[model samples]
Target: MKFVHRLCVLCLVALLLPGGPARAQSQLVLAISEGTSGGLDHGRVIAKYQDLANVIGGVLRTKVSVVFAREFATLESGMKDGKFDFVMARPSDYPARGMRDNGYHYLASAQPDGQCLIVVPKDAPIQKLEQARGKRFVMPEQVSYMSRFCRAELRDRGIDLAKENVQYVREQAAVTFYLDNKFADIGAIASYSGPARKLDKDGFRVLHRSVAQPYFPLVAHARFKPEQIKAIQMALVSLPDKAGGPEILQRIGIAAFDTSGEDRMNVLLDWLEK
Candidate 1:
């Protein structure tokens, strides 16, 4: 009886140890924050990311669940609290902050870095960025991330938006509307946005484009082991080359995943803050 009791106790200890059956069975949560305003519904968001989550789970040999973080505050707070095991989000700055202020590790960023396009009517005489000074401007809502991104880029070019005549709109389409109707001289829109994509067809031109920054960054929590982190990173970076990879990329709206944005991510907050 004594030997049997000792054996049972040893077995119990073994099961409780790290990487044991109990630990391996645990599920990790992946929080996705596309944006606060004008994001997909919960069901659609899950549908979009479920396959990617399954791929991650397959690589880790553990179950991965998806959760949508609809608000920036919620996403930021969750990262700071280490509530998420993995995070893949856009507007890039939030994920950048997750790495800097919160204890998260960079995994990868979506391909085709994001840029703020300085748009103007095709017939407009503003051929240079310097010529944009004192011109009327329209941009995404004042509090939105793109607005901050545009402001930072413009600031670097010596165009202080605080002094410029500006109209803040709720949507990128409205930025173009303001320009089309002669309500604004120039506007800022994200390079990847739909409105920017149709600029040429709509008789608009990009007067200037901001330096590209990492877009839609994916990060892992600090609790991830170095080997585990490397495995996850490798899995994501190679996703586009794998079977069903192209479809997944199409669903996620990215060309491919790039793991080389860590250095740029580290300095992102500094650029935005300044």
Candidate 2:
């Protein structure tokens, strides 16, 4: 009888111990931010990171699952609630803001820094920035970094924006479309935006280009252990050179990974404030 009682207690203790069958934990969750206003398919975004999740899982020796935020607010709330172990966010989106608000640490940035440009019809003969003062300007909606860059550059250059006719488009590509069709005299777009591609074919000249800024970055929440953060950072910065990494990075629109400082991110935030 005593042996039976002892066996029951032993079994209970084993079940209570760490790594026991009864103590199974949930898999880790990796959240990717969606800050694009429109023209983004949520499923595609989630699928893009699925392989990335697998890579991270291999690095950590644990299972990892990927979740894509429906939009900016969803990502912001999730980060504040500590729902994500890690996040990949755009510069004007959750990464920098979340780092300031939720103690997220910078892990790595997508290489080939981002730049914004003001473009005019190739034959417009608008050689000087002042020549665009009274032109009809088409820009992306307010949420985009391109929009903010355009506004900041105009303000800094002492251009009287109030004197010009400005229109906001839903997508960056639309800006080029409008400019190409003569709906607007000038347009603003990101250097790599769809419209930038039409520069040669559709005929547009860059009137101004903003200085380079850090690309989208991956960041980790403070709840992560130091070792975990270090491992993630190392894995990310080495992705460009890693064997299977180039393909993944290309699919995600990243040229490479950067371990440089986050100062450029701060500079962008400052522009946002201005």
Best by TM-score: 1
TM-score, cand. 1 vs. native: 0.89
Taking the tens digit of each residue's C-alpha lDDT, what string does model 1 give over 1-274? 9999999998899898986778755988889988744758778888999889988899888789889998888898999998888999988988898998887999999989999999999999999999988889999999888999999999999999999999999999999999999999999999989898899999999999999999999999998899988898888888878999889989999999999999999999899889
User: What's the number of clashes in each of the models?
Assistant: 0, 0
Q: Judged by lDDT against the true structure, how good is candidate 2? A: 0.77
Error of 1 at 255 (Å): 0.4
Q: Local distance difference test, per candidate?
A: 0.91, 0.77
The pairs that clash in candidate 2 are none
Residue 155, candidate 1: C-alpha displacement in angstroms? 1.3
List TM-scores for all candidates, in order. 0.89, 0.84
Q: What's the lDDT for candidate 1?
A: 0.91
Listing every candidate in turn, what is its Cα RMSD in Å to the true structure after a full C-alpha superposition?
Answer: 4.4, 4.2
